[model samples]
Target: MRFKSLRKSNQVFIFAALLFAGLYYGAGLLVPLTFAVFFAALVLPVIYWLEKKTGIGKPFSSFLGTLLIFIGIGILLFFFVQQLGVFLQDIIESKDQIISYLRKVQLKAADVTGFSLQEQNKLLEESIMELLNMTQTYVSGILTGITGLVLNFLLVLILMFLVLLNRDKFEKFLMMYIKPERQEETKEVIQEARKVAYKYLWGRLQVMTILAALYLVLFTAYDLRHTGLLILFGALITIIPYIGPFISGTLPILFLIIFGGTVEEIISFTILIAIVQLIESYVLEPIIIGSEVEQSPLFIILAIILGGMLWGPAGFILFVPIFSMLKIVFDHTKGLEPVGYLLGNERPGSKENLMEKIKRKIGRKN
Candidate 1:
């Protein structure tokens, strides 16, 4: 009986490994729809809860919640556009001075690094133009994309409503396949998976808000070029996790240096970026994600890169959460529990470091 159980377990594990492998590769093909569905899952819960609490009915509450969401999105987009326009106008007004500053910075770079600044500028300009041109190439396709976007939006909204409306039915559908003894465990897993998604969305916003304020203050105090833009950049880009901080921080530093920054000023900027990321990674992410979440820096980086490689920047944003959700599911299953352990935050040190610090402080006081 023991051997039979062991063999069954091993067989289940093998099947799960193959299943996930297919899903991982299939993600490349399904990212757009997957992301739309992912966002739906995030938004639907609140809409569902509100409807239940107030007896507002599914149709009206969903309509109201979706209207509010769209309105909020419009406001944010409007605000972003207005800010960007003003920032660009300021940059244009300072174009002559900006050019002069960049020239000086270029000459300085040549002196320090023995490179041709003109060549570097030409390369940067060409790269930017090339990317823009590539986007322009997709202009005709963009019309089709917009149409698809609208269709997808409607689909997601409908799906969300249906999912919420039939939440119990969906649970029953899944639970039907499982043994009676394991039905409760299966339900618990679904609940926990949703919580992971919710935690990521909420916690990410909180972390981004903190970083945005810090970047805004730092840039404004220092009189950095395009301060408003940099702040917006910091706020938006940080959502991408591992690569976001570097990209957000790097562009500003590069721009500053290209406009003739002192080495000390450059160092200050670098240090600030470093400190912010250290706090974000070592302090904030750990605190917010807690023991319930398990992800490594390396895996996060890989996920982002693979996501980007597959589906541009949007892919980078979605990849971690999608994989994390899968990890949660895999961990809960008896056969794939070991694989979950491998993927999850099992490090004793990073979490323990915080406790040890507290321990040392108490010992000192005694």
Candidate 2:
């Protein structure tokens, strides 16, 4: 029996590996669908509320919700373009300063490493030329693929609208496939998963908003060039988890250094970022996001890595909620509770065995 069980486990692992392979290779199609599903879930409450309040049908309400989301994205993109223009202008104006800073950095590096300045300059020029060639290739590829990218984006929007409109039908269809005895449990799992996803997405938006406001104030106070652009990009990039904030902070600091910021200014800004990160890690995340999904840190990190490997950036954004949904399903199912526990956050005193505690209570009664 033990051997048979082990064989079954191996089969399951093999199946999962195959599924992941498909996901990685089929990312072009799957990524947008994944995005649509998440988008549908995120805006579901708004759609329902609008339907209830306005007495409109689900189809109309879903369209309105999708439109609102599209408009919001459009506005953000508009501002991003404007800020990018300003950033480019600033870079152009500071070109000489940037070159001076680069030369100083090259010299400093040569001095520390005992390499001649000429050798250092030669290496730097080679690296820059390679980077420019890569950039040119990347730009051309993007130009060629722009049409398909737009079409895929539109398809995602359409899919999101359809999913929202037919959400009830989809739920019923899922229930129809399940055995009658398990239908209620399945429904409970579905509801729980939806609740977790909604809460997580909403909490993320709140966190991003607060962080952007803080960054804006801080950057403005420091008199940083292109403060608005930095804050927007930084806050959005922080959604990547872990290393994202460091990258975001480094970009602005590098820009400042290139454009003639003082050492004191650089040090002060770095210190300010550390302090803000402390507040975000300790206070804002706990209070605002809470423990809705309760995924273990190790598992979350693994998910981020796997997601990045499979779907690139979209995977990073989607994998946490995907894992959270899986956890909900595992928790609801009789045989998968162990898997759910493995994914869950560790809690103090939760290690006590429930059966042992029950036995102790019985002994006490005796």
Candidate 3:
């Protein structure tokens, strides 16, 4: 019986590996579908509310919700593109200033390292060339895929609409497929997953709004050029975990240096950003997001890395919620609770904590 159980466990592992391989290889299809599903989940409450509030059928409400989402996305894209154009124009005009700054930095480095200025200049030139090559390659790749990107976006919209429309049916189907005895547990798991997704997404939106306001006010007070654009970029990038703040902070600093910001201004802005980040991490996150999804820090980091490898930036943002939902499911399902615990945060009274508490209690008793 033990051998049979081991064999079954191996089969499950192999099956899971194969499923992940398929998802990776078929990302062109899966990425959009995954996005659509998540979006549908996020907006499901809106769809239901509209249906009840207006006495409209599911189809009309779903369509209305999807259309609203599309309009919002369109407006966001328009603003992003407009800001990007202006930023690019500024960069083009500042080329000479950028070159001068690079030369100054190169000279300082040469003095510190005792390398000849000529060698330093040569190294800087090579680095710039490599960076330009990379930028050109990335732009060319994006241009080549513009048509496919549009089609995939359209597909996501359609899928989101359909999913929202048939959401009840889908839930029913899932419940019906489960064994009769387990149906209630399965329903409970599904409800918990929805709660997790809804709370996390809503909390994140609140956090982003607060961050954007903070950034906008700070940037404006500092008299930064392109204040709105910088705030937008900073707020959007902060959605990615751990490394996102560094990237967001670095971009604005680079922009300032190239656009003739004073050293004091740069330092002051950096300090402001660091202070705001600390506030966000400690005050805002706790007050707003709370501990909605209690995945461990290690698991969260691994999920971010794996997500970036699979689906680029979008994956980085989406994977946290996705994994949290999976963790919820694992916690509810038989034979999967151990895996769920492994993914969970080390909370108070966890095994390690419990053992420590026991030791302390015994000492007190003695």
Worst 10 residues of 2 by lDDT: 349-358
Candidate 3 runs further than 4 Å off: 106-116, 129-147, 349-366
Give one digit per residue, the lDDT tens place, for model 2 in 212-321.
98988888888888888888888887777676777777888876776677889989988888888777765677666666566898888998999999999888888888
lDDT of 1 by residue, 1-366 (tens): 999999999998999888656656775446545654555556666777887788897667756655655565456555655666665455446555656775676687788988888786886546655654564445435443655655655665555555545656777888889999998888888888888777777677777778788888777766787676677767778888757877877888876775567889989988987887788777876666554555766777878887777666667888888778878898888789886766776765644545466678999999
- Least accurate stretch of 10 residues (summed lDDT) in model 1? 135-144
Q: What C-alpha lDDT does candidate 2 achieve relative to the native structure?
A: 0.80
| Candidate 2: segments with Cα more than 4 A from true spot | 1-3, 85-93, 105-120, 123-149, 349-366
Deviating ranges (above 4 Å) for candidate 1: 1-29, 40-45, 85-96, 109-166, 259-263, 349-366
lDDT of 3 at 70: 88
- For each candidate in turn, the TM-score is 0.73, 0.85, 0.87
Q: Quick one: ranking by lDDT, best first?
A: 2, 3, 1
Residue 199: error of model 2 in Å? 0.9
Report the candidate with higher TM-score, 1 versus 3: 3
* Pairs that collide, model 2: none
Arrange candidates, best TM-score first.
3, 2, 1
| Pairwise TM-score winner, candidates 2 and 3 | 3
Residue 143, candidate 2: Cα error in Å is 7.6
Q: How many clashes (backbone atoms < 3 Å, residues ≥3 apart in a chain or on different chains) does model 1 have?
A: 1
